[model samples]
Target chain A: MQSEFAVELRDVVKQFVTPEGNLLNAVDHVTMQIKNGEFFSMLGSSGCGKTTSLRMIAGFEWPTEGEVYIEGKPMGHTPPFQRKVNTVFQNYALFQHMTVYQNVAFGLEMEGADKNEIEKRVKRALEMVQLTGMERRKPRQLSGGQQQRVAVARALVKLPDVLLLDEPLGALDLKLRKEMQLELKALQQELGITFIYVTHDQEEALTMSDRIAVMSKGKVMQMGTPVEIYERPANRFVADFIGESNFLEGKIKSVSADEASVFVPALNAELSGVPMSKDFVNGEEVVISIRPEKIRIVDADAEKDGVFRAKVINSIYIGSDTHVFLDCNGVRLKVMEQNHISRLDPHSFYHKDQAVGVYLIPENTLVLKKEA
Target chain B: MLQRLRENKAWQGTLLALPTTLWLFVLLVIPLFLTLVVSFGRRSPDGGVIYGFSFHNYLRLIGYSTNCPAGQSACFDPLYAQILWRSLTLAFWTTVIVILLAYPLAYFIARSHPRRRNTFLMLVLVPLWTNFVIRVYAWMMLLREQGVINGVLGWIAAQFGLPFQPLQMLYTPGAVLVGMVYEFLPFMILPIFTSLEKIELPLYEAAADLGANPFRTFLRVTLPLSMPGVVAGTILVFIPVMGTFIVSDLLGGKQVILVGNLIQNQFLSARDPTFGSAASLILMIMTLIVTYFYTRKFGFGEEIITA
Candidate 1:
């Protein structure tokens, strides 16, 4: 059975009055659903309204126009403390004066729980975050990662209906961030609580989210699994945003159930893929995006296969792999090759300014719909 | 040798602090040492130091001798101790009153919007910009029998056709307290406000999310975080009020005498520098002990608010 949505925002709009007498819309009419027991993420750049949307669900802010519902109950003008949601702010917002135990027990104290129960839940939550003995330590005494875990424990101890994390890993270094991402995903799974994560980092969204809603300009552009977002992006923005991809402008020549032929102007050749939207007609201008890894470097003399002759612009050695950049049909594409015994052959290393044959698999090419 | 000198950071720090060390030695250490010496020395008939070591000065502090036609003989007096006790009581009450009034005002200023906060702070500080003597005189004028307060009270009574005289409000302990609080109120507000203002808003939000409501958040987070200011303000207001002579002299008239007024009398009126220095040294010692106690109790931990 599918888990029900724990938090839902229906056509919510949030606006702020600017000093110039203009109403600046931070979050437009956006609707979203976060499933219970799932680590859902709102992924976007700064000023993309992802945080605002999360804050709406957390009841920190009331929508200018629309309703937010938690567990199917309408939440109208509810303050943050009254809501069954806790947020982990980017800075970890720990109480400077409180010990970790006191910070974690804050919610329980608010609920007027018995002292024993508060202590038990706080201990349990701290244990869940792997901060058992550090409960009595002040937040400043902890490292960034430990402080972040304390913030998580503070929210988790409340057993809120949903845990909202707003760039919780943004302050961490790369290695710590990667570790916390995995720990957070595992913690979400173990606690069985809905986690609504907000971040502008695409790698964070890809690594932790069950599904991500790609936001831009105060609106959700696409919502899908990370693989789906990378492989079959609905529009040009998603294809460019999710990962490294090279695009070519083309015109649709023909359409079929499984494939669509487009006139590739650079190579004067026909490109084929399944268009994401069916509304595209003949002679419609479209963009085709092919992931960099899809392009393969082949020997120019290796049989006249479906390949184009190109020049290698640059080659980079990245420890475990070598990235070869080639200019194909006036478009730059990168090909990554894992360093291995066979690849160690002297002739296998392609240098810059060398002529090479680049082949792109038809199935790997993504046909994107034009966004108005 | 150059490299070794560059590496000697502890020596560099000590060198940097040398000026302050010398300053303290000259201003603080020397005077205290001198005061101790004077407390044990004898005072001449003209109130100058005779440089003779004796217990007579100490004996004279508790009870002096009456010089008749014969010679100096012992008499008894406990008035100084009683005065010291009264001074302690006044200082204690002044601290309590300042804390009670300063807390809410400081809280409001600390949490208010930037523009409004500055405006409110300006209001609190406006009275301080005027001359201290003038502010005290203003209070003196208001509390006097023929002043605005009594005139207003008399007018109200006459408007209602009641037979009554203006109430005696000036020259009382209440008037002294009013003047002391007015003079020192801003000292209390500023420190508490600075501490409260330094508290991050997210801390309060975090506290609330942990299940605290507004008041609980204030008690747990706001109060404790602002303890530095509260303690600083308390010490600042208490020490000065204890040593203050103007409020009691102007308002208490001859009805009451705080320790500050007594110390002032010993310096100027009694012209007994030896006894004055002894009492002054006692007050200074009390101040140092209280300050030491507060600093030792609260030195290097999170500021604690008993509330």
Candidate 2:
């Protein structure tokens, strides 16, 4: 039976020896399975081992422990040329000495394909990236965005089972990067080839990935869809990393199948029906995370079970939303309000030090385990 | 006045180039112009240049000679032409051999670890600390019949009870070629190493990812990218090898007579300043022609240094 995964990393670990005589685990024992034709992303900041993990998959580095497999066959020290995979490097890595057509045709030429066939595939690949007329230009003559497209075309022309990208658009400006993100996602869908993209950009990852593996400190924190990862983060790190969250320390008061009651001493109130990431015992310490947009500033007389008094310290009007900074009994919190009304009314803005009642919607709040 | 001059970029450029311009006019331009003039003038009875101008020296340099016996026309002499051709061939071979030897050593040094790479580069440059003539003389010592190589071979042969004869390696074309290659090898290595080291590590990975094996990667990626260095090193070695006479004089002895020896003999031994001036002008013209065609094909070697 054929394996469902196009690429699989089974407990891969890579260690590097530092100049100071210390052994460092650049990539710890990490396992991941990328489904066939799925756009999988590994996301983290610099030095978080995300690139190291991708390199292991590309056979640039061998794992000190465990193994990598492609198409259900173990890749035991297989050199990169023998592997049926291609990479779009961060720097675009186009051959500077060659024209765009030659760069795109290098792979087919190496495979000993007929000259006409190579030329036809190279033409089609360049056309796919919309670089048809610019075939004779050198890489140094192309702009950054154009060079990135050339790199993508060069890798895709090989028609490998999997394609790896290491921050392919990290050099572009914001507007071009956003446009390319959408275009790359569309291209992946059109080609039906599995893509393993590595990037530190959370927005780019969330925008294009079918599933993302959030990494920190050489370990995968969580792996799920964008909605599942952002809404129900597994731990304090995941919640804090994926999006902005105001964490309040608390102790578990009651537990159930899908909800928990947390008694937050800072807010001097008990939050009931809070969504739980895991079942916790009563009297166990935890942190309750609430997105700023989820917590609303309601009228003082509203009848809510989880309503608490807060004093607004500052209010920032940020075009689309107003960020209201509040102090609730020595615990600082941020609440975001969308500007739904028109004409910039003075009555819509909250004054400084105005006492208000904040409502914490039970289902929107998440309870996570405390990090050491 | 200084502020006004600074405001005008043309004036600023002229002022900055003033010293070098004057220096070139005094040392290089004036000497070359004098050589050209002397080449056209006739030689006096006491080997001094006379005021009359003619094409006698030029015609004589290209095989026409004036020492015909009384009624016949001027005869053809192939001595100087043969010397010039010999010099060209020797320089060409020296450049080719040096490139073959230096390219691999440069690759080794460039790919070595950073700490060891520095040591290797220093080793390549260490011999240059000595004078050029001294280095050539050292080669003479090794290649002589009674030299260190023959001495070691003699010892080995005596131990095995074989016939021991000192081979004649000195005063031959091979000796001169060996000396030229040894002396000019560093010029080739340094530039090639610079270009090779400037290549980023990711390009190799990208090539392999594109299905190129290691040998194919070197042929397509490494070799093409390092052409600027090869061109620069070739020019640096070929030009010097063409004009240098010390290595031939010390190693080739009387067997190898190049154009450099011809020019030296005319000026010093034969006291024919006019003939020497003609030879010098011809050498300059030949060098310029070759350099022009070379640069047209491969460009100025500026890219290797900048890269």
TM-score of chain B of each: 0.88, 0.93
Tens digits of per-residue lDDT, candidate 2, A42-120, equal 9998877899988887889999998999988899899999999999999998888888988898999889999999889
Interface RMSD of 2: 4.2
Model 2 agreement with the true structure over B1-307: per-residue lDDT tens digits: 9899979999999999999999999999999989888888877789788855877877887889777778967888887787888888999999999999999999999999998999999999999999999999999899999999999999999999999989999999999999999999999999999999988889999999988899989988888788788889998998888888899999999999877887898888888888889988887788778878888877734323212
- The sequence of per-residue lDDT tens digits that candidate 1 reaches over residues A63-159 is 9998999988889987778888998988999887778887787777778899999889888988888998997788889999999999998898888
DockQ in order = 0.53, 0.56
**What fnat does each of the candidate structures reach?**
0.62, 0.75
How far does residue B70 in candidate 2 sit from its true spot (Å)?
A: 10
Where model 1 places Cα greater than 4 Å from the true spot, the runs are: A1-3, A19-21, A275-278, A301-306, A337-347, B1-7, B41-43, B50-78, B115-123, B152-164, B292-307
Docking class of 2: medium
Instruction: Provide the lDDT at A234 for model 2.
Output: 84
